[model samples]
Target: MPKAIYAIWWDPNLGPFLGRSYPENDPLTSEEAVVIFMGHGLQQEAKVGYTKLAKGLVVSYLDSPNCIAVLLDENDDPSVVERNLLRLVGRINFNSSKWDAEITRAFLLLQELIAETSGQELLSNPHVTRLVEDMATGRVSALVPRHVLRATAKYPKASDYLGPDEEEVSRLLKDLERAGHLVPKTYGRRVECRQCGGTEVTLELACPSCGSNDIYKVYLVFCPKCGNRTQTVLVDDLTEVRCQQCKQPAKVSELSVIDVELLCKGCGQATNDPKIVLSCANCGKHMTNTDLLGGTGLAYYPA
Candidate 1:
């Protein structure tokens, strides 16, 4: 099995930038990056190949036109490493502008591969052992939702009990559930993009009247002394509204401020409710909430 995997971005003028690494603490250092660049002759030679270094045998692939990914292992078969690297890279979108997110996903995929390759080692991890022990002892009865929104899909609460990385914890919990150590209960559904099937969907509030996302809450200030209604403004720590008709400033205490409605900037219409639109980050697809695909939201209990 590979000891570490790296995603590196090669720049023509600057050199290599270490994008991400699996087992994050063990990152590919500057010296190693220089060696890889010089040894492979990346500037002048082949874009992808395998090479043996003092650290290990590295199987590299050109993930994108400028990005390279490599798997490092001292004793693993180079052919096997190359094959695994190809399989793992195939699942990632290197062309995406969101480099951080894509690189993180790539590393997570690498972690899964490492876990599968060394299942016993992973199960023996101190954190994993403690989590299992806690569940077995009834200390943690079930892994429930941390928040009402983005519930099972993000597993925000799992980090509190399992580990700092919610995604990693979620993956571990799913592994245990798949292994029959935990029982799963479906309580809700998540919306996913129908085109790309990506779960990273964001909800946008659009004006129902004009179907525009440029909506702002309307706040009106009413001054009884001047019998004027105008927009409120923040002056230092106080709310002040200057009437256009009387040119009199009214303090917050002397005025009745109300949140009238959500006003659309496009059509100048106000409404209490706005249309919810689901947008896919991966494919840039926009659709109504009802048009999205439903995914299961789950809570887990020790079996």
Candidate 2:
């Protein structure tokens, strides 16, 4: 078990010395460890791993511009400590508002998960380690939230690359939630493309006949002077409304509103209701809104 966890931010000029440390009087110095790790001059070094420290092993990971180091006991498994650190960082980053309180809970969960009642390290199971690693830093964009109970991991970038052990990851996250190690938060539902399961779908109302997104709100007005029933176009500071026919001009308020509808810029079709189209940004597939898969989406943070 690790005694303390430190979330340190590394700066090129300021050396590596910002962020909060847990259990302040620990024997290890996480900031100095981060400085030493960065100074190693290996751009290709593995971002997450464990290394020997002065008193004990330090599990350190580079979280982009910041670093998190955990000081572990001599008898502790280094890989387990590293995995736990990643998981903690995942939680901290996911729910930044409650991070101060979550730091203690994460370390406690890590200690519990590291050793079972029989004193066996769970890190021996490759499935467990992989699941934890994926939960922390999977190939997901920051804006996208990976569903905790999803069957397979989605790869929006690579069309053909299937994720490895995705079911296991999903199962592991659910189990963690049940064990009070994960807090799930829902941010409403999203419709995804049925073919590629891409969530980057745009819900647009377009011309059904032409399939054009260039639809504009149009107001048809009746010009009393010329008796012209034509499309009313607002011009010159929006105070002047002109009829398409007869070039009759009147104040916007003076014209009687006959109909308000969406006019398509492509085929010039005017209708009260526009066609709901779902466009997949990833694959450029156009389909009806019904073709999308709707599900309750969620995100999770360590409890």
Candidate 3:
């Protein structure tokens, strides 16, 4: 089986370093790891594995994959990761509060399934069926709890992804929870913030394509049914970019910046990244930081 190890980091801004602990050193130590998971911060669900080449890719991801890490991997494959993450988000994101269990489960399934050789065909497997059942039964977990009991006793070992006694399955769950991907709900206790004791959080939501939050203002050029506008965002991963307001469908390289607003999955609001985009955990839509300033409070401007 492919060995897997998980880790989590919590902070207001997760966009900085994915795996590395912010304001600290690289390769975080387990001792400094928090004892609990928070409902805020960035959540990363990573599962790294190699099939040993002889195993021939046995089984389609395992029933629930147990309490696997919510966020995983920090390879330089930002392009692929970003595209997949946004694609998944585009399908489910409604531009409102943080993702719920249903949303988390959907993405969890998506991440696990996307890598498979035959995804749609593999859905019929018993393991996939059980995962769906777990999600429906409300026993699903996108992130492991902070005080997690080792799943080794039950599963007897890490799934095909992670390796040995590296990081307990529980720790992976905590990382996901911290990454703002999974919702942590346990019995007889409440999940609170690890930082300021404030459970409330604000995540920037923007156009997954344009990475912008000016939804209401820009003239949405795409049909809104497909990922046309979205393809524009990834036009050039190598450098700064301009929108490709092509009168017709064209290559991302052929596109040029014009007037339009993009949408973000972090927040459900339409926004362009070049401008100000804010994520609102309250409602999973994209908005300007100024959007929050509208209601009798500290007024600020869009940067």
Candidate 4:
């Protein structure tokens, strides 16, 4: 199966708007979409082909003048992938305002077609069978991620979606996808702690000088006439700053406002840039952005 499928549309003035991705939250960014649109020569005319990227094979089809669909897969058979992609594209109504709902319906149809074409057997696993039954009976619309760091660590189970444990539910969902009954979508990415392999991480802005999290924003009102500076005070229905040294009330426009500086309470140091630290709630490990491990989050939906 393809790792992901993307639907992209171009505006004559807006460049490209990524309409949707199967796993609704695929990590493919807007800039990468533009690169794909240009790199695959999709702007000139309608075409269908595959190109190998550093990550995987990108099979793209410009189904219309302003719209294109792509499948990111590592399958060796580009022709087979192209054929399957065309089958999906043919069912989508690109002109519809409700493009999201239209594309989702198309995916369901595509799954049914693929299952029939491959003569795939129905899933017989009891756990997955019950999950499918629940879906069919309207008990569950989708299997949602229980936590923000769901993709980073396996310790947190998707207990909210189903009664079973996370690992068991995940394995069952994979079986459903392999059997052509479910589809996976990328939702977002989360950071993991390298020290303990935990996803419960919190971000904090520490003082660059003292490495303390006791930092706060300060609003200072500066009188340009007298070169006097004073902390701003709260007054009802006031639109001006009264300089304490100058003893004059002037319009705020006449005074320079320095509100961008972040003051550290620990060291009394003021700076605009603070060091970003990621602290793990599990192991109490602190790390920088480069030291954290990243993982992709996914959610499952019925095909």
Instruction: Mark the regions of model 2 whose C-alpha exceeds 4 Å error after superposition.
Output: 27-31, 39-41, 94-100, 116-303
Write one digit per residue (lDDT tens) for candidate 4, span 213-297: 8877656778766887876543457678777787777786676776566788899998878887777765567865644536566
User: Poorest 10 consecutive residues of model 3 by lDDT?
Assistant: 58-67
User: Candidates 1 and 2: which is better by lDDT?
Assistant: 1
- Pitting candidate 1 against candidate 3, the one with the higher lDDT is 1
Model 4 C-alpha RMSD to native: 20.4
Write candidate 3's Cα lDDT for 127-188 as tens digits: 43454345446655332222211112111122222333323333332233333333544322
lDDT of each: 0.64, 0.58, 0.33, 0.61
Q: How accurate is candidate 4 locally (lDDT)?
A: 0.61
Best by TM-score: 1
TM-score of each: 0.54, 0.37, 0.17, 0.35
Global Cα lDDT for candidate 2: 0.58
Residues 24-53 of candidate 1 have per-residue lDDT tens digits of: 767787777766665444332433466566
Could you give candidate 2's per-residue lDDT for residues 201-279 as a string of tens digits? 5567888789788878788888866887888645456877666787767778788888878888899998888888667
> TM-score of the candidate numbered 1?
0.54
Clashing pairs in 4: 23-185, 25-186
Higher-lDDT candidate of 3 and 4: 4
Task: Say which candidate scores most in lDDT.
Answer: 1
Question: How many clashing residue pairs appear in each of the predictions shown?
Answer: 0, 0, 59, 2
In terms of lDDT, model 1 sits at: 0.64
